[model samples]
Target: MEQEKMNLKLDMDVQKLETKKLRKGKHKAEEDLKSLKTDYKKLRLSMRTVGLGKTLEQWCQEIQEEKIKVGRWERKFQAAQMQNRSLENSLSESQNERDELKARVAELEKTVHQYRNRNSVVELKASFGRIEQMKRTVEELEMALQNCEAKIEYLEANDDHQSEQLHYFQDQVTKRDHIMGEAVV
Candidate 1:
């Protein structure tokens, strides 16, 4: 009985050790499986990122589409360049026309200024002529006024002489009348 008990205890200890080893091996296998799953996810993400997930035909098709888009954009860019050149040319023409117009306006203004100066000269000359004519008229009027004054002075002197002659004649007539009356008496 004692030998049998020893054998049984040893067998139990051996079973415990084998259970512990199996548990450890199962935990390590689970960790390896988790690591493998994470590596598989990273590999798939890398494949997509590197464009390796698509087939060669799909890549070729996408490249062809991109080339078509590039061609279209190039055409549009060329057309825009042509339009820009046309606009630049038009702007240059407009600027030239504006410069010509400005020159014409300046010329017109200069002509107007010249005409105004001529008109001013003519007006000044006319004014001088009018002033000269007025001066002559004033001189003639002064001469006529002097002559009229002289005539008035002569007429006044003649009137005074006539009044004195009349007074002397009347006095002589009265003396004759008085002598006639004395003779008659």
Candidate 2:
């Protein structure tokens, strides 16, 4: 009975040592699970940060491109403004030239009208002078014709009287010749 009691006490001590070892192993496994969970969370946070950084870079690049386009458009606008100003100046010069030409044309028209009026007055005066000369010539020709008619009438009357005297002389001569011839016979 003494040997059996000693063996029973040794068995009890071995059971206590096994219980302590089991508890230590369980605590180690729980610590390992927690470390794995922490590592997963860190990985998720790093992935999100990398994705946001790429998005920000893309936005910055778009903004830079837009700025470049705006600069190019501004230069084009300035050039167009300069061209418009030059065209306006050219238009003004053309208008001034047109106005001057109009004034010159009006002056020339006025001069032409004055010359036409003077020419008409000179022609009227010349026509009046010609009419007066024609009247004087007609009067002189009529008086000369009357003098010639009077001289012709006088010459015809004198010739008729001379012819009557010549016929009387010839009859007297013929009667004398007849009386002489009778005496001779």
Candidate 3:
């Protein structure tokens, strides 16, 4: 009878230890669940803040919109570049004409110098009239050259403005690319 009582007491102690271990395991699992819930919430909030929570369809739509904008900018840049080339060509042509006029004027002045050395009065009078005519032509050429220079200056200014606009558009493209990269990541 005493041996049976001792066995019963030992069984009770074993059951109590098992119950305690089970209770500790349950508590640990609850704590782990709470931690997971908090971490999940934080992750969701971060995703929203970083713009990563957008749907795949939304991202695709945005990317398409950006592509359209980029295409428009590229077209504008090409047009501006073409205009710039044209302006450069015009300036080159104007310079060539100016140079030709200068050469012509120099030749006329040399002819006048030769005429001035001649001894005939009639020849001198005729040469003087021709000289006046040449001078008027030279003045007109000078005026035309001045006009060409003004046009060149205006074209250069316009080219500068177009270059600035190109840079601005390029910066916008870079910004869009960065945004797209972030979205993809």
Number of the predicted model whose TM-score against the real structure is largest: 3
Q: How many residue pairs clash (N, CA or C atoms closer than 3 angstroms) in each of the candidate models, in the order given? A: 0, 0, 0
TM-score of each: 0.36, 0.33, 0.50
**lDDT of each model, Cα atoms only?**
0.64, 0.60, 0.76
* Model 2 misplacement above 4 A: 1-60, 120-185
lDDT tens per residue, model 2, 1-185: 97988888888788888888888999999999999999989987776554433466775885687568556655655555555555555555555655565565556556556656778767555555554554454455445445544544454454455455545654755575455445433
Residues 1-185 of candidate 3 have per-residue lDDT tens digits of 98999999999999999999999999999999999999999998788767676799988997898779677767766776676677667667766776776677677667767777776678767767776776676677667667766766776677678668767877987897678657756
Query: Which residue pairs show backbone clashes in model 2?
Result: none
How well does model 1 score by local distance difference test?
A: 0.64
* Tens-digit lDDT string for candidate 1 (1-185): 99999999999999999999999999999999999999999998777655466678976986687568556655655655565565555555555655565565556556556656788777556555655565555455555555555554554555455455545655765676456445534
Count backbone clashes in candidate 1: 0
| Clashes by residue pair, model 1 | none
**In candidate 3, which residue pairs get closer than 3 Å at backbone N, Cα or C atoms, i.e. clash?**
none
Arranged by TM-score with the best first, the candidates are: 3, 1, 2
